[model samples]
Target: MNILILANQDLASNLALNLLLPSLQRHTLRVFLSSRVGKPGALPELKRLRFFEQSLCNEMLFPHLPEPGQRDAQYLSFSQFTPLLTSPVEIVNTINSDESLSRVSALKPDLILSIRYGGILKDPLLAIPKQGVINLHSGLLPDYRGVMATFWAMLNGEREIGTTCHFIEDDSIDTGGVISACRLTVHSERSYLWHVLQLYTGGCELLLDAVERIAYGEKPVARPQSTKGGYFSFPQAEDFTAFSQKGLKLVDEEEMLEFFKHYYY
Candidate 1:
């Protein structure tokens, strides 16, 4: 099968790719990584969120990833893995634009997979693939929808967090029918970043399973979302305060470093 993957260019998304892409070697794959560039006049909170996210990626994640023309057996870096891909990855912000649509149409993808992709897929783009687009959302749907879902789940004092694999039936965010969902225990001692990173392991497995099922000429079952789950945007300052009050953190450097040691290296 020819698979086109739309994913975010971020630490967590990259980690997901690391887990997923290798297994997809059997299929023809094209990847487009969406940038996380902030919009003009973005809120300070959004800017701060982006800053911390980029800092973690720059300071810790990227350094461990392989450099151009370099491959280290000790660790699998984004640079190292990408070069192994049959097609060169495209980085684009204008995913739904005319040019992008043309480019994607030319590929003639049998299936489209989205993981933390920033852009919304319009009807034209959604119509391009034969099997249609499936997204691996970082949160379970109907209950948690939209950005920073794990944060919202934690802030709401949920003991478990989840990831959902669902069909992208339209332009709405995370409202698609569910193919599968996986849950993980929320460890109070772990950083929010840690939990987010951990989700991809199970998430990617679900995605891979979906792909395999599709390849075998089986349509993966999808259940429509029955309830209207609350949608969450980036947290406000007061929300962060509440998170802290609950003894949770956005990032824990030491814990992340230790995790990286075993997981990445």
Candidate 2:
């Protein structure tokens, strides 16, 4: 099977891909990493989130990322793993552009998988893959939808957070038929980033199972979202203040460093 993966260029997405790609050795794979940049005149909160994520990536991930054309390292991060892939990884700014459309059409993908991809895919690109597109969302559907779902869930004081694997049938963000979902206990002691990163472990497993089912000619069951779920945009300053009041940190540097040891070591 020819599979095309669309994901954001960040530590969490990289971690998910690292866990997923190894199990997909039987299929042909191509990856497109999104820059995840917002439009000009974006809100301060959005800018802050972007800055925070970029800072973490720069400090913790970029230093260890393999350089262009440099492949053989004792330990391989997602970027380093590219040299061993059947297709060269692409860093895309406009996923719906004519050039991107043409490139995807050329691949003749059997399926398209999306994980934390920043851009919204249109009909032209969505129509290319025979098996259609499946997305791994960090939050459960019909409840939490949109950006920074884990943060939103934690802010709402939810007892458990979940990851949803669903079919992206249209341009509507995360309002798709549920293929599968897995939940994790919300640990109050953990930072929002920790919960966000942990969600992908189960997220990748669900994605792998969905892909295998589709590849084996079995139709994966997709349950329609029965309720109209609320959508969450980036949290504002007040929301952050409330979160902090509840004793939650946006990030725990020490915990993150410890988590990265698994990939780096």
Candidate 3:
């Protein structure tokens, strides 16, 4: 299977480390990345920065992930992997550009996988893939639609959060029928960042499973979604205050004890 991957900095590294590298063993994989340049943010600059700081702080709340030295960096963006990130990948600032479309046509991919990629897919590019373009979204279907989904899930004090892989029917965000999805247990004790990590780790497996099924001529049935859940954007300061007041934690007592035993003692 020839697969074309579309990703950006955040989830790009996640896809590469979890899915793309493994997929290369069997399929001919190529990547189209949106240069981490001027992507539009839903919030003001100050809010975006605040969210970023909060995200890093959230990471500290979790148990150490046992990444040795440079391996820790691999958990970051493409640059962390360096040469091995050296797949037959192309970087495109804009995915809908004529050049980008020409490149997509050139690859003649069997399937397209999108992960946190911002660029819109249109017309010929959308029509080119044999199996179809599949998006690995961070939120569960019709309920948790739109951007920063896992954050919203935890913010709402919901206990269940998960990943969704849907066949791209149109240009809408996460609206297509679900092909595959896996739910994770989200304890109220856990922070939104923890849920994000859950998606990063579990999401890829679901994607690979879906793609493998596609390879075996098992086209996933499209489960049309309802428009019940409203869309979301970036979080505001008030939202962050709520998140903090809820005492949302990324790691609980037992996990912290385990971290100490493993790393310190």
Error of 3 at 55 (Å): 12
TM-score against native, each model: 0.90, 0.90, 0.76
Candidate 3: residue 138 Cα off by (Å): 0.6
Candidate 2: how many backbone clashes? 0
Residues 58-97 of candidate 2: C-alpha lDDT, one tens digit per residue = 4666676656446543334555667556767678979899
Q: Each candidate: what lDDT? A: 0.82, 0.83, 0.66
lDDT of model 3, residue 236: 72
Model 2 spans > 4 angstroms off: 37-52, 58-60, 63-75
Kindly give the stretch of ten consecutive residues in candidate 2 with the minimal lDDT sum: 68-77
Pick the winner on lDDT between candidates 2 and 3: 2
What lDDT would candidate 2 get against the real structure? 0.83
Q: What's the CA error at residue 188 for candidate 1, in Å?
A: 0.8
Span of 10 residues, lowest total lDDT, candidate 1:
68-77
lDDT of 1 at 239: 85
RMSD of 3: 5.7
